[model samples]
Target: MSDPGGRGDTFCGINPEALQGTINSLKRDAGRLRGSATGFKTRFDQLGIDTLPLTKLLHVASWADDQLPMLRRRHHLAVLIDKGADPVLHYPNCPDMIMVDDADVSADPPKVSDVPDGSDPKLNADWWGALTPGMRAELTFLYPDRIGALDGLPSTVRDEANRTALSKEKGQLNAKLNKLRKDLAATKAIPPSNVDDVGGAIGGDPAYELQNKIDAVQSKLSGIAAVEQGLAKGDHGGFPHAYLLGFDTHKLGHAIVSFGDPDTADDTVTYVPGLGSKLAGAEGDISRASALWQSSNQQAPNKHVASIYWLGYDAPQLAANSHGADVASESDANAGAPLLRRFTQGLTAARAVSSPVHTVVLGHSYGSLVTGRAAVHGKGKLADDLIFVGSPGVGVDRASDLHVDPSHVWAGANSHDPVPDLPGPDPFEDLGGNASSFGTNPASTAFGGHVFQADQDPSNSFSSVDLDAHSSYWDSHSESLDNLAKITVGDYGDVTEAPQIPSDVPTSPTLVGPGVL
Candidate 1:
């Protein structure tokens, strides 16, 4: 309220009347902004854009509406969305990003038959959010009708409406997208049973609420887009920024990242998430938030492992109560290959970083799905060891089904875990089966003749407990950890049991939870 460093004749005024007028003008602007936001939302719903992740869409819309009258960026964006004002025409630096089509995914047997080919937002937003703003306008262009419909509106109205709507929808979409993603990731987090001690030296599983921290980061550093751009450009030096590499059916991308340098550490760890993965999804798990990084940090402190969490596509969002072993292999394995591909690339990149990269790829539940995808695709074999914990299937019904050299593979499952018990269908695409011909407990299955180090978490006793075994790999003194550490250090993981995979008729939900992973 201090006179704002008043200049005698230069001030915009100190009169009560002037102040009142300024306030009234601001109110008018606010009202205009509010009205504009409302109308744009309707238009956005029409386009099937998720109101959640579309924050930028809305902001730009509002901005354009306010400025198109005076010709600003929004004004330009409106011209692009409405008048075919080619985005490339103006920016000339949009990088020619072609949004990938969501349809390319090989369709699975209809989980529900009344399908409309691809994901239906009102129905599927629970799994796949609406397309991204970039994809909406310039990339995918799902709403051709809407795009054509704009021709009916005049430039002034069109620009205002388009700007307002795009900004509003984009803003809302991002919000909803983040929330959905958080809930989805949280849903998959199966807490390690023993609350007492974990990771040997790491203490009680390091607590990191991944979403809260990542959200805080983007809020402070730059929005998701900025961070994504930096990663694409390799600009953020070791900050562990989030990225959605490429889309499959949803915006989920299998992610690969370098977490630390060998000059700094003696070991490395790769963490995989459960069903419904996203580029940032796995890392966002509350219990596992930067979970791998914790292991890297503890491994001799400054010396650390450059870890990557496999979050790229693996399967569709799961049902409220479904397990990976119960889902379709095509959905699980196909999407997973990219994640493996990226991991291998990251591994190669790690090697070039002037540090000896001792690597371990660890799978939990569908994480094992991704690892197997890599193995089947003939990749990820360069790692020190292969570990599967709380697994449903790793592309094989027994240890010999995998492509890796037998000595490097191993398995560990948590107590009373349900994942290992989920049904595997006949003529299965993955490795495990319950056929007595192969012979073994249903839960101990691992494809490709890989050996298991020892009984997982010897502290816990009791065989299968539903499908929980899908992610029990990290459960207490669970024997999987021993080999995980050994693998991280590049010592050959000693596998003793030459077990076979067990298969069962799938009675589990086909697709559950928020669709992703």
Candidate 2:
């Protein structure tokens, strides 16, 4: 019998080869359009016509630029169709896919409830593994936000879903911001009335309220922009492709961005930031992860290294009048512990290789406490190695208390960073009182963890401990970052050891409570 679908085309009636050729031609046209737009803009600039009123009328180039994303989407769909692949699985944006209202509802893909419990990593992995590509793609397209946050799914799948979620979030936030700005302007246009005389219908300070809403929306947008910038870094630098594993804009916000694919990488490092960490400050955290990835890759060029910045937990903030659950207490760490544990377990459950991948978990300042609690969450070890830098404490007096072997646990504390010197719950006790506010100082001799060199720039003339030293642990070309990178890549012997805090150091003078010092 003759093939009715044409040669090399199975599912679709179109020939794959011909469609690919058309796609190539479309790509060429897109390139030319881009070039033409650039040329037009350049000529306008050269003629000083860009600043004239006529420039506003010359929007052809802008229109062309706006069409690029749609063309790119078309290209993506064409390529997928040529390969007979599932569109929802490979497509970058879910909303861009065409939806048919007449489509059969009974043919919908499996929902998250199909699994026993989506939060359980092993169960999630098993459920995902059992799904067909088409089903998986459909499910991902329908529930990008939920699927993206699920831990056991493949990193690439999560990245695609999360990118769609991010795009939708950015668009929504932009719209809200514009509306809020308009409202603020309208409110401002109203003459200022006496605060006491303003009617209850108008409420107190309408303009101020609108301005607050605008500020909040702008903050979220700024965070989204930061994430986009982080993703873009992968295109130019020698760095591997960046992945948005998870994200949320609620409250302080949350994000899990990876520098490389953790499932396939030989080595993976997950770094958790400390106090005051939020989505708006994600650029700095992402940069730190990128820096660590660069340093570790340099050490082991042949091995694939993935670095992840995990701000999944609500890190404590230093605020006046804040008593419990502040940076000084273990409330945040205790709450974040189980989540961190589940994340690490998900990493293990989602691995594609039978051979184990070396995984390291590093926490800075308050994050160390969270990491520590996660390590000791259950019977087994959470990570192959644990690194605590600028930590107040890890909620334990001894490294042996953590599930990992004492030898595999490491600590780094700069002399100028006073966080490591803060008093623990007990001032006089040998082991229990070593840490500042959490528990045992992991860098202390009593803790029995290896201490590594982590000094601030010697060029600085400051003689006192300060916040600058606490934040400089990830500085490029610094000893602290180099040591961290070495530990991350399993190059332990090369790491320079630093002196541990003496067990007998007077805890009385260091009894100052934490409030950001």
Candidate 3:
């Protein structure tokens, strides 16, 4: 019997270390056999003798080559299971007890109903660990949508499931788009005088409604294309393999793309974007994550870093769209807080045990508010560090309120970035005194967090705020990006600090300008 409690021993009736050893031995043997077969074939050809036997041997070697990867995958799955389990189960190496084949592995698999709710990351991890390799594969293949979005699953597994789901969704959206186009064409063909005005009277113009549907479908297709483009760049130019951890076309859309495998990384940064962030515009966000990864890797060349572009929440829009939330309000952030907290917890849960990760949660613009809410309301610490850049506020008056050490909380904003100057909600409604819409300005001295230099592309004129400064934090060769990378890799000593904004000074143009009272 194998000792599951011992390292390099069997777990869940599978010996991953043993499987790895077998795979290595088989590979070596296969290589030697192929070499011998080639030599034999050469000798046979020289003597004008048939080389069919040697060719068959070579074919057998090729078959082994194909099967080795599957066996190796099983080995990896077993290791993951062992790591996640509290007391790993072991079994004898007897033929009857061993999982010798896919059929044996799948036999009497656990029910999907046994899986815990996605809300609890620890339970989700345990449930996933209990399943055999074949059972997990079967479930992923059968229900890609559910598996792709499930918390506490491996990034590689979720990537595979999401890719399948993305393909199916793309096909469905394309079909729907085609039908809507046909409907639009048919509606347009009708004579204006003969067409019924009932739709217009009850709702809106039929043609206009059809056009809106077509536009929405087209937007979804574009978002899918963006995701595909991101995935296509696999480990090129120092950027790690892109993983589509989750995605959906509902409402303004949602996507979570990671530039590296978070589970195995030494450092991981999850970035959340703010207003006007939707699936269609996810390409920019994805690129930002990639940039962050590159910068962080450069800062800590030895440490493996993963940067995630997390647009998992339905961000509010500046103008009312199909989704009605306003960017000026905290409703969207309030709704996204729990989801963000769960995702961070899931990342922690699914991470490999041997390699502990230093997690950083970075939120930009309105996303800082969401991050703040998540940190404040969560039962435990949401991340090792929290970074807020170009933010109006973080839904909290002080850095300590975010459930992390004040020193670990960092904030940055360009001097000309107007968003940070926006007035928060009125603390005393009866007095009609206003403040930041979300809460206190996180970069202010009163907030008690380290303020970092992010004043890239400063506005030439002090009278007007530079709107472009708000989006330039992740720009190439920027101080802000460098500081962010430093913070992400836990190189706190190297981070450059910035002068904090005074709490009493009203910086907004509507209140008091830079030179004004």
Provide TM-scores for the models.
Answer: 0.43, 0.77, 0.74
**Per-residue C-alpha lDDT of model 3 across residues 1-517, encoded as one tens digit per residue:** 2443453644335566678888998999899999999999999999999999899999999998987866776665456445432234445444322332345343444455645568788788888887655567657765778888888988888888898899999999999999998888887543455446663312266777887888888989999888777766657875779989998888978899998889899999999998888888888889899999989989999998889999989887764333222456788899999999989888988887686789999999889999999998757788999999988788888889998999999998777677777655564521222245577778878788999998774433344566666787998888999999999999999999997666565444433122110
Residue 188 of model 2: what lDDT? 45
Return whichever of 1 and 2 wins on lDDT: 2
For all the candidates, what are their Cα RMSDs to the real structure?
A: 19.9, 13.5, 12.4
Over the stretch 184-283, how does candidate 2's per-residue lDDT look in tens digits? 6666444446244654224457776786788798889888888888788874679998989889898888999999889888999999998888888899
Question: What's the ranking of the predictions by lDDT, best on top?
Answer: 3, 2, 1
Local error of candidate 3 at residue 52 (angstroms): 49
Clashes of each: 73, 3, 7
Screening candidate 2 with a backbone cut-off below 3 angstroms (N, C-alpha, C), the clashing residue pairs are: 422-436, 423-436, 435-441
Alpha carbon lDDT of each predicted model:
0.43, 0.76, 0.78
Mind giving the per-residue lDDT tens digits that candidate 1 earns over 150-185? 211112222233334334444665676577567646
Against the true structure, whose TM-score is highest? 2
Candidate 1 lDDT for residue 78:
31
**How much RMSD separates candidate 1 from the native structure?**
19.9
